[model samples]
Target chain A: MTSTATSGTTSPEPRGPRSPGRPRSERAEKAIIEATLELLGEHGYAALAIEAIAAKAGVGKTTIYRRWPNKEELVLDALAATSVPLGELPGTSLRDDLIACVEYVRRSRGSRSTRLFPLMMLEGLNNPRLRERYETVVLEPRREVLRGVLRRGIEAGELPPDFDVDLGVALIVGPILYLTKVWNVPDDQLPDDVAARIVDSVLDGIRARR
Target chain B: MTSTATSGTTSPEPRGPRSPGRPRSERAEKAIIEATLELLGEHGYAALAIEAIAAKAGVGKTTIYRRWPNKEELVLDALAATSVPLGELPGTSLRDDLIACVEYVRRSRGSRSTRLFPLMMLEGLNNPRLRERYETVVLEPRREVLRGVLRRGIEAGELPPDFDVDLGVALIVGPILYLTKVWNVPDDQLPDDVAARIVDSVLDGIRARR
Candidate 1:
C-alpha cells in the first residue's frame, strides 16, 4: 500500500509551471495533518494510531514517514497549524498589545484545537517526549511573542525597569485561560470587554485606594 | 465473591459496645476509596473499573455499590478526600486571606491528587456526566471559597462595592495555575514568596505609576 502511494508521487505526470494543480506532496501533507488532528480529537493521544491516520488521510505510511520521522512530530505540526498566530502586534501602547494578546486567547477558546489542548497536556503528564516537543514547538513560541511585547514595554518606559516578564506574561494570559480552559465557560457567556477589563485591572490593580 | 463479602458483613458477630476494633464497614470503605484513588492516578478516569477497584481493595463490587451508586460518585468521593482542606482562614485582612488562598493552591501543587486533576478534567471534556459532577463536587466548592473571600473584601470596602467577584477569583488563582498546570513548572523552581507576590501584585497592580 505504501509502495503504491510512493509510485503515485513519482508518476510521470506533466511537470510544468502551467500545471495549476497544487503539488501532490503538499496535498498529501495537508491531508495527513488534517487526519491527524481529526483522529486526535476523536480518540485522544493515547488511542491514536499512525496506520489509522494514514488510512484516514488516504495516504501511505511511507509517505507519512518520509515527511515526519514519528507521530510526535506529526502531531506537533498539526497542533502548530491550529494555534492562532499572534500576527503583527500593533506598535501601540503596552495596554493595547496586552489586550491584543488576551484577545487572541479569547478567540482561541472557540477553536477545535483549543478543545484538544487539555487532552494533549493530560497525555503529556505520562508522556515526557510529547510534553517537551509541545513546550518547545507550541508553548514556547507563543510565550516568546508575549515576552517580546513585555520587553518592549520596559524599553519604552511603559513598565518599570524591574518588571518581572514571566509573571507579567502569566498575569496577562492566565485569567483568560482559567476562564476558557479550566472553567470551560461558553463563548457567549465570556464578556466582550473581558480583554480590556483584564488588561486595565492588571495594570491599575484591584485595590480600593483610600 | 460479592455474595461472600455481603454475607461477611451480616454474619452473627456479637454487637458489643466494648469492641475496640474499628467497624468492619468503615475499614472496607477506606480500602475501597484508597484503591479507587490509586487506580485513578495510574489508569485515569476512562480506564478505571469497579471490579478492578473491588479486587484491589479486597472488597466486593456489592460493597462498593452499596456505598456509592456508580463510578462517578465513587470517584468524586475519592477525589474529595484527596483535596487539601483550606481549614480556618486567618481573618486578619483580605491580603492575608488572598495570600492564604494562593498558598493553598501552591501547596496543592505537590500532591498526587493534583497530578491527576488535569487527567480528570481532560476526560471531563468528553464525558458530560463527569464534567458536571466535577464542577459541582470539586471546582465549584473551591471557587466558592475564593468568592467568599472576595465578597468579604467587597463588603469591607477593601475593594469597591461593585467589585466583580468571579473575575477577582480568576485573577487571583489564574497565574499560579498557569505556572503549575500549564507550564508544568517544577516545585523547586517555584519561589517561596510567590503566593504573597501574586496576591500583592493583584492587589497593587503591575503598571508603573507614571
Candidate 2:
C-alpha cells in the first residue's frame, strides 16, 4: 500500500561531481539520516543547520553535502526514513484496510518523529522551498497510498464507480486528522473501532444505495 | 454558533496592589492584545515574549503582568480576539445549518488572525499552559457553538437521535480544515458548494437511511 518512489526521488539532487575516492559510506549515511530526524524533532526546521547535523551525525560537513545538496533534501530523506512505505495492508475488505491505515497513525502518534509533524507544518508555512519538498516528500506520498486503497475499493465493487474520489478521500481521512492533530486526541483513544465507524460512514455515502 | 465567555476569565489575575492614583488604562489593554497577536503571527508563540509584546504595545511590563500574570493568558486573549462570536447563521434545516457553519470557516480561513492557527497548534504541543488555555479560550468555545447546532439538528428530527455528534462534528469540520490548512488550497477556489457536499455526505450516514 505504500508508495515506494515517492520518498527518495523528489529531492533536487544537487549532487556535485563525485570524486574517485572511497565508495559511499552506507554506515555514515544511516547515522546522518538518524541524526537529522533527531535534530528536526528537537529544534524544528528553521533552527536546523547542516553543520549541526554533521556534528550530530559524526560525519564531516563535506560528506553530508556530497549526499544531499541542501538542508531541504537532507530533511526530506530523514522524514522518508521515518515513514512506513504504504505496503499492502492485511485486510480482506476496505473497512479492514482503513482500520489498518488509521492504526498505523495511532501507533506512530506518540513517537518523536510524529511529534515533529506540528513543527514541520509550522516551518512549511513560511518556507516555500521546504513546503514544496514537503509536498513531494511527505504529503503527496501518503496521499498516494490512500488513493490506491480507494481506487482498489472502487474496483472491488465496495464503492460506487461514480464516487467523487477527491471528496471521498477527504471524508475518509479528514476526521482522523482532526482527531489526531486538532483535538490532540490521545494515541490510545484513537481506536480501530472509530476507524471502522468512519469507513462505514464514508461508505454509506458512496455505496450504491440499495 | 461561537462559544462565549471562554476567554478573559481563564487567566489567574495576580493583580498586584493597585496604585490608587490611576485607573487601569483600557487603551493600553487593547494595544497589548493587538501586539501579542501581531508578534504571534510574525514570530510564532515560541519566539514571542512578554517583553517584546510590552515594547510593541508601548506599555509598561507591569501593565501586562497586572492583568494576565503570564504569556499564556495574554496569548489566549489575543487568540480570542481573532475568533468572532458565533453569530446566528440564517438557515432552516440541519443541512443548511451545517453548511452555514462550514461557510464561516471558509470565510475566515484567509484572515491574518486565522492563519495563526497552525502556529498556535505548534506552540500548544510543547507548552501545556498554552494548550489548556487554547482549549478553554479558542477550541472549546468554537466547539460548543457547533455542538449546539448538532443538538438542535437531533432534536428537530433532521438527524438520528442517537447520532454520534462528536464524530459528526469532526467529519463536518475536518475536510474544511484539511483543505484550508493542510492542502493550503487557494481561498477563491474553496467554493460555497463544498459546504453542501460535506453536509450531504455526513447526512447520508446519520440520516434515517430511507
Candidate 3:
C-alpha cells in the first residue's frame, strides 16, 4: 500500500498553524479513508459529516480538512481506496477478456463498495466536484482497460473493423450496471456466463433459423 | 397529483389536530410536490430537504409530514407524479410496443422525471424499503409493460415460446439506462435508432452477413 513512500519520509512533527509535517500520518490517512467509507455505507452521503469522520478516525478537524478540501473530496479519496481495481487484462480469448471484468464486479458484492458507489452517485447529483473526481479516478481507469481490450480485438480482426469502440464499451459495461443497479441480481447468482452471453448476443444477435 | 392518496391519510383533517374546517389546501399539496421536483432537479436528493421544500412551497413542516411519512416516501410520491403511467398492453408488434415505451421515456426527459429518476436509483443503494418501493413503483411497472408485450408476442407465435422473457426485458431496458446513466446521451437525443437497433438485435442476433 505504498509503504515505501510513507517509510521514505519520517512521519512529520505536528505543525502549528500551517501544521508542518512530512505530509500527514499515513496510518491516520488510511484510518480516515476507512472511516469515511464506513460512514458513507452506514449513514449515506447526506448524513455523512466531516466532523463525524474526523472524530471516528481520531484525527483533528484540521487534519481531515488539510488532506481533503471538502466532504466530497474526502469521499472521493475513500471511494478510490475501496474501489476494486480493474483486474489485469486476461490473456485468453475474447471470452476470458470479458470474464475478467465481470468476475471482478461479482467478487465485490458484499463489500462496502456496493453501498458506497450509489451514495457517491447520489452525491454527484449536486456536487460537480465529486462528479469530476468520480469520472477521473474510478470511471476513467476502468474505461482505459476496456479500451485496451477493444483495441486488441480490432487489431486481431475478431471484431469488425468499424465496430464502435465506445458502443462496445457500453455494451460490455451496460449489463453489469443493469444487473447491479436496476435488476438487483442476488449476490450469489450474478451470472458468470453473463459476459459470454453479452459478447455472443451483441456479436451474433438472437434471431432464429430463417 | 393525487394528494389525498399520496398523503396516505384517512382524512385530510386529522382527528388529533384542532380547528380543521377547511381541511388541508390541495393548492399547497400540489405546490409542495412541484417544489420537491424542482429542488430535486436543481439540487438533487442529498441537498433536497423537507425544510427547503416547505420554504419554497410556503408550507410548514407539519404539512409535508402530514402528506408523506418521510423524505424517501415523499420523493417516491413526487417521482410517481412525474412518471408516465405504463399504459395498457399495446396490440401492436413487440417492436412497436417497445418503441411506444421508449417514446414515453424520451418525452419525459427534461421534465421533473429525468432528474428525479437518478435520485430514486441512488436511494435504492442501501435502503431496502426504498428498494422494494423502487421495484414496485419504478422498475416493475415499466418492466411489466415490456413483459406483457413480450408475453403477447410469444402467445401470438410472433416470438418463440421458450424465448427468454426476462432477458428480453433486459434487452429493452438495458441500453436505455446505459445510454442515459453512463454515456450521457443528450436529453433530446434518445436515439430512436439505438432503440430500434437494440430491438432488432435482441429479436434477430447480430450474425455476419450470410
Question: Each candidate: what lDDT?
Answer: 0.79, 0.74, 0.67
lDDT of 2 at A128: 69
True-contact fraction in model 1 equals: 0.56
Docking class of 1: acceptable
- Judged by DockQ cut-offs, is candidate 3 incorrect, acceptable, medium or high? acceptable
Local error of candidate 3 at residue B82 (angstroms): 0.8
Give candidate 3's whole-model lDDT.
Answer: 0.67
Give the residue spans of candidate 1 off by over 4 A.
Answer: A1-22, A206-210, B1-22, B206-210
DockQ of predicted candidate 1:
0.44
- Candidate 2: tens digits of C-alpha lDDT, residues B42-61: 77777889899999999878
TM-score attained by model 1: 0.86
Candidate 3, chain B, TM-score (2 decimals): 0.74
- Which pairs clash in model 1? none
Give the lowest summed-lDDT range of ten residues in model 2 chain A.
A1-10
In angstroms, give how far residue B191 of model 3 lies from its true place.
6.2
Evaluate model 3 with DockQ and give the value: 0.34
Chain A TM-scores, per candidate, are: 0.85, 0.81, 0.77
